[model samples]
Target: EEKIPGVYGIDTRALTKLLREKGSLLGKITFEGGEDIEFHDPNQENLIAKVSTKEIVEYGSGDKTVVLVDCGTKYNIIRCLLRLGVKVVFVPWDYDFTQMEYDGLFISNGPGSPEFAEITVEHIRKAMEIGKPICGICMGNQLLCKAAGAKVYKLKYGHRSHNQPVRLVGTEKCYITSQNHGFAVDNSTIPSEWEPHFINMNDGTNEGIRHKTKPFFSAQFHPEASSGPKDTEFIFEEFVNLL
Candidate 1:
């Protein structure tokens, strides 16, 4: 593990920890075209084999929850998920795949204007159409609203601080949250199929929402906050239960 201020790098040990192997490699490396040994040592320089894994480049996962992310937004949420025993997969959220097979999906926070993410939106739509248990925060939340036929509107002044207060709606409980988004789900554009789950008590803007029927939900705040309050971190618990 290498950390230099805001940038970090991953090496082979990180890969091992991510594979959840107690210093053990699972299965065997197999080559394409089907004519080779199923197992071998990594030291074989003469081996003619290559295997492709549906790798989680940025996020970490357990043996179960296969979480996904919107590229670079996977940092803090991944740490929380891993602590909760989840197997995460983080890749550029805009990749096009005809079908996806995963136990669960988690979209992480990222910077930028959410409306410029058309490709990412399409991928999210496909994931939603597949109907797997999904959770999203920040940009992930915005994408969820977009996938569910809700409109995303930019705030005149975005919430980009860590000390924002988010009300859970039904309760007077207010969680001090970490947030960084200039856009929010237009409450009026939300379809009846979805129910607002959390709200920003300060402005009454939509903060979190869940599907009325499907196992899809999102939050506009960052719950997996590192170096901040973990008050809203229970969202990961909710995800584990939902999945």
Candidate 2:
């Protein structure tokens, strides 16, 4: 049984259509005799701080070490890296990871706007100069863009499915992906030194970005999709290759 209170029997299809047309809306589901409540917008909150680990955590023991900046990261992300024989040093969202010795840096997916994680972005800027291989996923992608001076904005309704199509930049190849983010990087605002790595086929939005000549890149989708397509699992390999 569902633990949370819920009101059912509504036309979910109509609601989905309305959301598609009107974008993300804030609303409260009220049951009979329930008091009216204000709809809170989670986007304005620093959800990363709330969900990120409070202290440093390490997993596995491998020669190649990866400092994973946890911003509400999925367990599958760590599992994927650990599968690659990477010793993972999981840290908090705002932790200063630049000081730690590691072969690669990874920014994991998280919730809410990238603005709240400015501290993490600052650390990323430092990591970028350090020249260690770096990879980011979802909100991590947004933070990397922010570190590079690119702008990020909230998406309309957001991408939340396993079948989203993405095309490689400057190539004809396309991959079906799993995604669940409500913000996107503004390609037009992306700096000259960095270029788009992937593009969303449906909306033509930037799905990924990479530095011109550095081992720095990020994807706005989940490559460690346990229940979704395996096409992008190669992404973890690509990141490991950088290490």
- TM-score of every model versus the real structure: 0.72, 0.94
lDDT of 1 by residue, 1-243 (tens): 565334236476777676554423335545459788756443332111121123436445466756465445646666777887877666555655425556888776766656656676787788887888888788788877887889988675577788988888678888998887767898998999888888987788999889988888888987887756779888888887777
lDDT of 2 by residue, 68-174 (tens): 99999999999999999989999999999888999999999998888999999999999999999999999999999999999998887689999999998989999
Which portions of model 1 show Cα errors greater than 4 Å?
Answer: 1-61
Worst 10 residues of 1 by lDDT: 44-53
Clashes of 2: 0
Per-model CA lDDT versus the true structure: 0.72, 0.93
For model 1 the local lDDT of residue 147 reads 79
